[model samples]
Structure formats: C-alpha cells, structure tokens
Target: MSSDLCGSRLFLALPDDILTIITSSFSPGDLCNLGLTCPGLDSFMSSHKVWLFQCDKLGLVPYTTLIEWRKGVFSYKALCRFLVNIQPMIGTWVHRNPELRHVVYVMPGFLSVVGCRIIPQEIGPLGLEDGPILWTPVFEILCNHVGSTSFFLHGKERGVDYVYPGLLKSVDRDCNVLLLEVEHRHQRGGGKLADLKNFTHEADNEVSSSQRIVGRKWTEKPFICLESDDRELLLEFVTSQVRDIVPDAANVLLFPRPRIDAVDSQQDFIVLHERRLLLLQMYERGNMNHDLKSDEGSPLNPTELGSSEISKSVDCTCNYPASQAAETKEFYSCKHWPYMYESLSAFYKFPIRAPKACDEEYAGLWGGTFGLPPSADKPGKPLFLIYISYEESEGKQQMIANKILDGKSRLSPFNGSTMFIVNIDEPSMTIFPWNTDQQSNPISVMQSFKGEGICYWSRHRYPSIEPGSLFVLENGLLVYLWEHAREVLTLKRLYLGELLKRGERLPSFPPVLNFAHLTS
Candidate 1:
C-alpha cells in the first residue's frame, strides 16, 4: 500500500447507474472532461446510448449549423478541415435526415444552432469508444415548422371593412398566389401614382429618411397581395410588414395589388415575386444546392446544337486530324455540358410555368367536370375542395364558386373516384362532404357541424372537427388556410383565431414549407 492506497481511500466509489446519474447533471463540456479523466470513466462516456440519454435529459442534441465547432470555441479553420475530411459523412447525415438539410447563410460572427433529440446512435464513434457512436455533429440542424408566425390587418382611420371576399380568394389550390396591398396614408390628399413613385425614390436616397417615411406615412400595413418593385424594396417592405404581425415572421408572403396590364399579358408579377421570395427564403434558411466541377478548366458544350452555325462547326470538324479533332469533339460533347448550361439558366430565369387561363366561361375552374375531359373507368383518388367561410355575402359566394371551378378543372377526377366538395357557410357552419356518383348530382354527407363565425371542412375526417368546437382566435384576426385541409385547419385553430378576436390582421401570409411539410 502506497500512493494508490491513499488515493483510493479519498475517493468514494458508487454503482455505475448512480455514477451515470451524477455525471448526467454536468454541463456538456464538464461531462466531456470527466470522461477524459480515467479509463473507467472514458469507457462510460464513449457509450452511444449514454450520449443519447444525455441529449434527451439535457437537450443537447445536434442540429444543422452555418459553422462547425470544436471544444467550446468558434473555429473556421476547424470547420474547413472538418468539411474536407468528413464530407462523405456529412452527406450521409443529410441524406438520412432530409428534413434538416438547408442552405446556410452566415456572417463571420453570427451563429445559428439547430438541435435534434431523435438521432440514431450508429453514425459516428465518440473518441472514448472503439466502434462508431452517435455524437452530435459539429453543426446543428434547424427546424422550421409552420404556425410559428402570425398575421394582422389594419383599416383606414375613417372606418374599417373586413374584406373577407378578397382574403378568401388570395390563396388558390396550388397555394402560389398572394394578393397584398400597400396603403399610403398621406395620399389622402389625392397624390397621383407618379407622385408616390417620386416620394419612394427620394425616400430611398438616405437610409434615415427611408426609415422615417416608412414609419410615418405607411399606415395600416397588411398582407393583402403581392406587388412589383425593385427586389430590395419588395424584400424590405415584406420584412417590415411581417415584423408588425409576428416579430419573427422570417418567412412571409408580400402580396402587391393586382396590375391589370400584367394580368392581361399573362405575366403574373405576383406569382413571379412569390417564387423569387421563396428561393431567397430558402437560401436564408440554409437549403443550398450542391455544385460539382471538373478537375480541368474545360468549358462544356453540347454536340446537337440547336442552331445551324453550331451544327456546321461540329460537322466540319468531324473530318479534321484524328488525334486533335477527336479530343476536341470529346471536349464539346461531354455529358455535363447540357446540365451545366441548364443550371446557369435556372439561376437567371423564372422556373415556374405560368398557369394557362381557361376560357371566360370556365375561368378559375380546375380540371374535372366543368372544363376537364371525362375520367377513366378505374379512376384514382378524387380531388378534394375544402372551403372555409366566416360570413355569407355576394363576394364570399363568388369566391366559393371560383374555388369549386378551379378545383374541378385542375383535379380532373375519373369514373369511380369523385371530387369531394366541402363547404363551411351559413348560420350554423357545417361540413358537407359531397362526392360525384353515376347520377349527375353528388351525394352530400353531413359530419360534425355548429357555430357561426367560421367553418372548416375536408374529404378526410379529423379529430379537431367536433360539435360546438370553440375555434381559437388570435389577436382578433380570422384564419386563412393554405394547401391541404389538415395543415390549414391546424394553423387556423392554433394560431389565427385569437388574432382575429383581438381585431388584428397578419402583416403577411406566413411562408409555406414546400415538400417537407406537405409529405410530413
């Protein structure tokens, strides 16, 4: 007995389970340090399950991040080295967790951390362990869920009219349209559109003046429709309006008033603006596209060129010296040529195809009975049109009719399957699920129905639809649904109801999460 006996006497040993409980209470850094102190401690610390348990208990799960870190400090050099060494591992992580992937935008000092508690423990090994363990990646994943933002409406000081009709029609079946209006309070003096334009230009000259003008002159900011302007101004206005409704309305839709000329030309500035904003928001949220480059700086060119000049060059060069010409032709006809060109084009041009307008008789109708061809014998699922209305009016009626037509034409149901028409309207808002049968008139089945202010309906029944259900309102603002029935209702009951009751309107339509939210 010597130094070993003395050290052993001073330390109190506990069972493994009890020791784990004690260690779990330590901070992440401390826990890591304790694991390094002795062989026995290191073995326990390296356990993947142990780390997972710690994540659940302490909420230290890893998420996507703009930069990777080591120890407790910010390290760009470490991040660069990590990216080079573990790129394949990172790719695997992203593939496994597709929802967490995003395009990371960051400044030098700014940091955003995303945490995930549900990670599997087989990816990588902690240093203390022999095999792979699920250690939090250097960067965290960001979670962007819906219902995180709010909306509100402000009316003219004289008196306010709740333009429910316009609001109902703003979001179509595809969830692509956003109609917003910008009101100029000082324009009460009858300033011309040209005058407003000049005012906007002058205001842009100085940042302080711009802030003052936006603060004082722009009153009653609401997310009514999308507008056309310089990209920066459009972004600024959108961000400003969103701040009024939800200070963290990071993702939003800014609708500008309709332009009659643009509408006639089939150049929907609103749709274009929405797509642009969507891409920008995606970039901001860290959903970046990967780019692959060749080792040599060779420019890729297509072999089957569209124009006669290019065709001639290829044909003429076909008979040149075998060695030099063969290499030249191979360079031009590389498979990567077309893909690279298309990638560049996508960056500059609008990618979404504009919806072709139906004739006046079938305007706004989607594909089914109204203007669509007849369905096949064994049809697939029928398209569902769920309409929510708070009050009855001529405008509301028109909106409903327009939605029905649009859904019918676009969906184009087949023989067996029928389009389900659900409406929430009248003294007692009720859900009427109507499906087309062999007989021309569709059968209507009444589900849970009650109350007056607003109604919700869908082809699929959900738990939220109940008799005498008290629809939750936020800030005195009515709820508007986007995309499918479930998400729309979920958002409404959870976020919009209180806003409506409080007499507020959303400054902007919250941005819709694309494929991830839809499929999930």
Candidate 2:
C-alpha cells in the first residue's frame, strides 16, 4: 500500500477516544485547520472536549464561557474572577515598565471580565487585601494602557487623571486614589504642592519653550495632547492588542474621542478663519460704525452700521409690521426668527410623517371603544379564561408587570379581559363572562359576556390536565359549537341508516316521528 493510503487507513482505524487525545495535543490553530479536512475529522474535532478544557487552562475558556453565558446556560462569574486575578499580574508588569504598559492593559480580554470577583484566597499573595475584589474591566484595561508611571506623572502634573477618581475610588482607595498622589510625589521628588506650582509656571510661559519641548511637556503631564499621528498610533496599538486578546474588543475601543485636542484644534481653526473673513468683509463695506443716535427721526445712514450688526438689529425687528416697511431686502432674507422657525418646524414636520397605519390601528383601540368597563356588582354567568404564564418565577412576573406599567397613562385594555394566555401552562378550563361595561343589562346576550373573565390555563401546570380539554371562548361562546351541533345531527342520520340496512320499516298507521327521542 502507498504510504499516504497507509496513513489514511491508520487514521480511520483509530478509535474516537484515541483521536480526541491526539487532537488535544495540537494547538488551537492546528486543531482548527485539521477540523476542516474531512467530515470524520470534523466530528472528532468538535468532540475534543479535552482540547477545550486545555484552552480553559490557558485562559481561553472565558470566550467559551461568555458564549455559554449569552445562551443563558452558565454563569460568567468564574470567568470574570479568572480575568480579575490576572489583572494584578498585568498591573505589576506595567508598573515595572511604564512605556509598554498602556499597550498591555487595553489589550482585548483584559477588561472583558469586569464584574468578576477576585478571590484573594485563590490568587497567591501579590499583597492584595483579604476581601472580594471587584474590578471594572474597562477602567483597569484603560489604566493598563496608561502605565502607572505615566498615570502618576499625568495626575501630578496635569490633573487629567482626576476624571476617573469617581470610578476607581471604590475598587482600591489607596492604589487608584492615594497611590496616584504618592506616585506623583515620587516622580516629582517633591510634594503635589510643588508640582502644581511648576505646572502653573509652565502653562504661563508657553512662549518660553519651543513647540517640540512644549509637546514633550504636555506628554509629561497627565493630559497628553495627542497630535493626529499620536492619535493614530494609540488607536493602532489598542486595536492590535485587542485583536490579540479578543478580536471583538478591538472593534469597540478603536475610535478616538472627538473632543481630543487635535480634533478640536482643527474645528476651532476653521471657525476662527470664518469669523476673521466676516470682519474683513465689514471693513471692505465701510459698515463698522455703531448706530449711536437716540432719535429714529434722524436720517439713518444705510451703510454706517456693520453688515453683521445691521443684520442682527433688522432681524430682531423684521417680524413687526411697523418695521416691515423699513426693513431692507437683506433683512427679509437673513433668516432670523419667523423664517428660521418656520423652516425648522417645516423640516421637522416633513421628516416626521406619521406611520400610515397609526390612524386606523389606534383610532378605535383608544377612546373607550375596546377598553374594559367598570366591574359589575353581580355576574350573571361565570366565564372561564385560560391564559399561559410565560414567566419562570413569580417575582419575575411582577417585575415585568411593573416595568410595563411604568410611564404608561393607560392600562392595557386586554388585561384580565382578552385572556393573553400562554401555551405552557397545565391544560385546564376557566369560565367567566366578559361583562366589562357592567351595564345593568347587556345590549345583547353576547355583549353582556364581554369583559368579566378568569385565566386558569398555564404551561407551568402542564401534564396535570389533558391538552385537548382546555378551550377558549370569544363573546362567551365556543367557536366550534356549530361544528359540534353538526356532528350530533350526523349521528342521528347514522342511526336511521343502520335501521334501514337492518330491514326495519316505518309503520303506515299514525306513527309519531320523535326526533328528540331519536337524537337522545
């Protein structure tokens, strides 16, 4: 036999248990590649629970755990704890080397474990306190990216780190809060008091330093003013590191904040240039003088006031009938209040057209047409309504009801009347008349049965009652009653047919045809 054929035969001959063991020995990538080879191998690859267990040991289990948790099958708490336990290790590494720490902390999967409990007992003493430590994965991940040294330096020098004290204070008051000052002090070799003074002097003397030096100074401070290049680099690092840990995390945090210095500077520069151009236009038009004259009777020089100010003044009064005649063509088209308001209202009104079916669907449903009437003092007939309960727990049901009721001015018209039943409950029957209008006498017999009802069927009670026994009534009558009556008539015809087949004949002498007796 050929060597390839021999190998294929050998592989095919191996037991599933043995194949699983061999596949488990391969890396995740290798196993993934092997899984694509053949149907038999794919089945073996999928069954490789031992390989998954190994992945868990290497901290890859959390992703699997996350998927399971999303499916509502398992708790993510343990995975969270695992992430939390590893956080300090990351912190320790970052603290030792500040430069690459930011790259490490914001790495994907770092903060994916937020809300996980860090058990001090399970993790060997890195001197963490003896309590359940819950870390915000996002903050910790961000903290990791901005290394301890950089964070301390920034907090002490620029006060930028103060934005997170509210978030980080609960975790470790000393480390995230007090340690900030301590680290700052250590970095400065002087107190926070001295650092503030130095920072103030540096800000006041902006002209004393070159742009390169000023940029470096900003970097030294907690608030790093990122250039376009720096923003790109930061995003690139965050994306790459997140992809390494968890590809999904990279997608979320890759966008830079719009309010950052580089972005704001560009926007501000454009606005400033626009304002400067307006000023130059006013100078060219010879309209920079103020309208200081108190009397309106005095002749007004049309070009004396700045075009911008004249536009503003005319816009303020252009709506009045008295000023309408005096207003220039520019004032009419300048788009002050009436024109702007109308334009905006029109724009909003045009875009926010009502849904086509809203009028037809809601017209009668509201305004008391389909709503429940007041309860009656006496019920003439009992009506049973069977509804299924979808909620797993009683507490959950109440919570859902409260949430539904919140901010709602009207109760659901169908509540307790329409029998919004679920299919999961036990097969059972309830009888109640719909008597919501509670009029002393119903307009019609069927109308009297409108709203008075009771729900009894629920999937929670299934198997106790036979499935077909449960029935629903609309307008207090069974929908299948006519069919049932037809079946009764058919039975009578069958009885008469059988008699005829048996050679039985009706008597000629005055015999009474008792249909009631025949039906019975």
Candidate 3:
C-alpha cells in the first residue's frame, strides 16, 4: 500500500503472459501511465493487442464486433475515436412537442448509426415482451473507413421511400437542442458538404451569394447571417444536383430493442444483424464513397460531392481543386420537402439527463400525471412530460415549464407554450394544501415561487395560464396549485425511457399505420 510496494521490482518482473493479463486489468488511463514508465513497456503497450484490450474495456460493443470494426479504421486507436465520438448519440431522444411524440432511439449499425422514430399510439393487449414497438427509419449517420460521419435522412414521397443524403460537418458532444432546417453550400470545386456555410429557415429564404460561413452554428437558422442574393439557386441546386435520392423498400426493421432483453427483441436482433450488413453493401453499390479495404492515414477529407457518386445523374463539371477554387462561394440549396423531419431527428443531440439530489441544473426534463381519487380510474390518467428552462424577462429570473407529452384525450396546446411561469423572486403566500406530501411523508419545501398554472380549459379548445403558486419539494417534486380551480399538479424529475421500460409493455400499431406516421 506504500510507495515501497508501489515501486517494487516484483510487479515489473512478471512474465509476459502474466504481464499482459495484469495490463489488461488496468484502466485505460492507468495503462497509458504504465506504458510511459519505460521504453520496453512503451513498445509493448503500443501493440495493437493492447489497444484492442483497452477498446474492449469500454464495453460498448462486444469483443467479436470490435474485431470486425477494426478493419474500417486506421488503427484500434482510431476505432476507439469513432466509438467515443458516437457514444453520446446511442440512446433515447425525445421532444417536448406533442406533434408525433418525437421519440427517437439511436443505436449502432454496421459501421453506422441508425435513428428510428417510435410512433405514438395506445398499445394493444399483447404487452411489452410479446408486443412490438412500431417505428420507422428516420435518418442514419454512416461512417467512412477513416471514421468521418455522413448524414442521410429517410422519408416517403409520391408513394416511394427514399434516402436523402447530406454532409455532417461535425457533432457537438453536449448539444441540447434538436432542430430541422435547410442548409446551402457553394457548388464550386469538389468541396465536400463539411465546408458548407449557408443556412435558412424559410422554405424560400434568400441567401446572399457573398455569405461565407466560417465555423459551426450552434443555434437555429435565424442566428446564421445570410445575404439576400439568389433565392432560387440554393434550393434548386440542392434538389437537382447533389440532392440525389436512393430508392428504398419498406423495411420495418430499423432498430432492435436490445435494451429490453425480451424474447422477441433478441430474436429480431439476429435478423437485424444480418440485415444491417446487406443494407451496408447495397449503399456501397449505390455510390457511397467508402473504401472498405483502404485505411488511409487521414480520415475522410472530401474534395466535394461534385460529379461524384451522389451526383451521378447530373453532369457535374466542377474541376477546380478544393484548395484552388474561386474566391466567391457558389450556391446550392436543399429544403427538399420530404426529408426535413427525418434529417433533423437523425442527428439527435441527446436524451434527457437525470436530475441530481439537490441544487440540480435549472433546466431539465420533469414529468407528472393527474392524480385520481381512490375511486377514480387509474389507467385513465396519462403521464405528462415537460421541460423546465430558466430565463430572465424584464430583469426577473423566471422558470418556465413547457409541456411535451400528455396522455389525456383532449385538445392539444400550441407549440412552445409554457405550462407555468414562476417568478423566482416572489415567495408564495399560499400555504401547503396538506401537511403530508404525495408519498405520505412529512412535507419539506426547499423553495416556493409565485407562478401561473396552465391547463386544459373546457370552455375553449386552447388552454392559458392562471395564477398559481409553485412549491419545490424535496426529492425533486414540484407541486403547483391553480388558485381558481383549487386543483393541484404534482410532478417530479423523470427519464421517460426508464419510466416506460419499468411499466407495462404495449403493442405497436399495424404495419400500415406505424410506418412513418407523421402527424398532419
């Protein structure tokens, strides 16, 4: 336990077999430090086998799969790079909008990442295990041999399914917002989509030809600067040239519910495994520019999509070297009608984060349900999901909770309406409704705020805010009391995926209704 034992020669003298076993047990960080101790260890630690062991320690992918993935990258180190970069995306993503539930689950595919949208519907009696989760292929982030990612959006149009390809310049590891928009680029030189700069929100927003995007834009399109030059050219070039579509068959299987650990999911995983490989091959045949056999020293640095595989149908005459291209940026726009939503959901920012025990981030996902009296129907009450965000209005710090998913069979609220707005500076004058909380425990209030409650009003289809007091309780519970109606809304910090998994399994809709069932 002391420094003498730490520097002892006995550990260094272990035979090669035992040494490797010991090294394999070390954490990736510790192993690197061990490697730096001596030149003999440096060479040994740099071996492919040692890196592979470190890769396996991550436990993201199985060992057998790592062997297969090794062929696609320059080295085990590069493969690890791809894995770490994408690990944030491999989970559930949801939106606060009621439009289509916006429940997208991301999972790994054959050297790619697949995004599947889970349709919202009442599950049938088959239950979760025997039942299926209805979903459609939303988008995919495919990997090049060198680990660069390409984006593809899936959608149906004119009675046909298609994949609209695009470029992913890069992804932020901690992105919090999800948005769908139209992006433009100069069509000169063989510049890849990564170097693009133009962006617009309007279906017909005009972009100035002189606008040059220097770096990534984190916010929505409105924040990006654009000059009003050629309006039609951006959208026109996107649809005609680089915006080539790939014919897609109706494939219900996009993701295997690997986390559920049920019989049906495991059984489908076998078929899904083989299905992914075949899909990868077909994509390669249809002009995907990846060299499976070549592990180039550098990653994917494309000259451009000009006249290459994606733009085969059009006669692209772009010949200038990427470095030698003209000064002015050429324009190509893509707000192609069909693939908007699919593309947006494909590059999911992240799922919700769990709230801490105390003084958690002001912005997080919170959920609640309408509490029923002892005799009321239990199953009738639906789980409601909302996102809590903080902002300053007129120099007053206000906490706003926006409703996402509601189970009630009532008219829906408008998009982006705050369920409650709390003035954090004002303390609540209203006393607690009951001495005990929802769990029959003693009431403990961390803080209280004067706010207004927003709920469904029977008089009209749309709901509005009413005066109320918000009580922040212990263990992340938020209680709101509507002053007029004297009704209470109880909520808590929630992770939707976890709640759904622990609850009952529900049946998916028929295949006809389930596939890409976007709300009209």
TM-score of structure candidate 1: 0.21
lDDT of 2 by residue, 1-520 (tens): 5676565456857776777676656755576577688876666655525344433545532453334322221223333333333332221101111111110112222222111111111111221112111111222212221111101000110111110111121222112111111011222344333333354222334332333222234336531233333322222211111111112222222111123476664554344334323332332332223232323332222222222222222211111000000011111211011111111100000011112353211111100011123221112211111111123444322000100000112222222122221232342343323333344544222211111122222333321212122123232222111111111000000111111112211111100010000111
Which residue ranges in model 3 land beyond 4 Å of their true spot?
1-78, 87-112, 116-136, 143-150, 172-252, 258-266, 288-352, 361-363, 368-383, 389-400, 405-414, 421-451, 460-464, 467-479, 486-520
Lowest summed-lDDT stretch of 10 residues in model 3? 319-328
How would you encode candidate 3's per-residue C-alpha lDDT over 180-208 as one tens digit per residue? 32344435552543232222222223322
TM-scores for every candidate against the unseen true structure = 0.21, 0.21, 0.53
The lDDT for every candidate, in the order shown, is: 0.24, 0.23, 0.49
Return the candidate ranking by lDDT, descending.
3, 1, 2
Model 3 per-residue lDDT at 378: 26
Number of backbone collisions per candidate, in order?
A: 58, 26, 7
lDDT per residue for candidate 1 within 52-126, as digits (tens), equals 444445322132222112221223222232222211111110111123221111101111121111112111221
Over the full model, what C-alpha lDDT does candidate 2 score relative to the true structure? 0.23
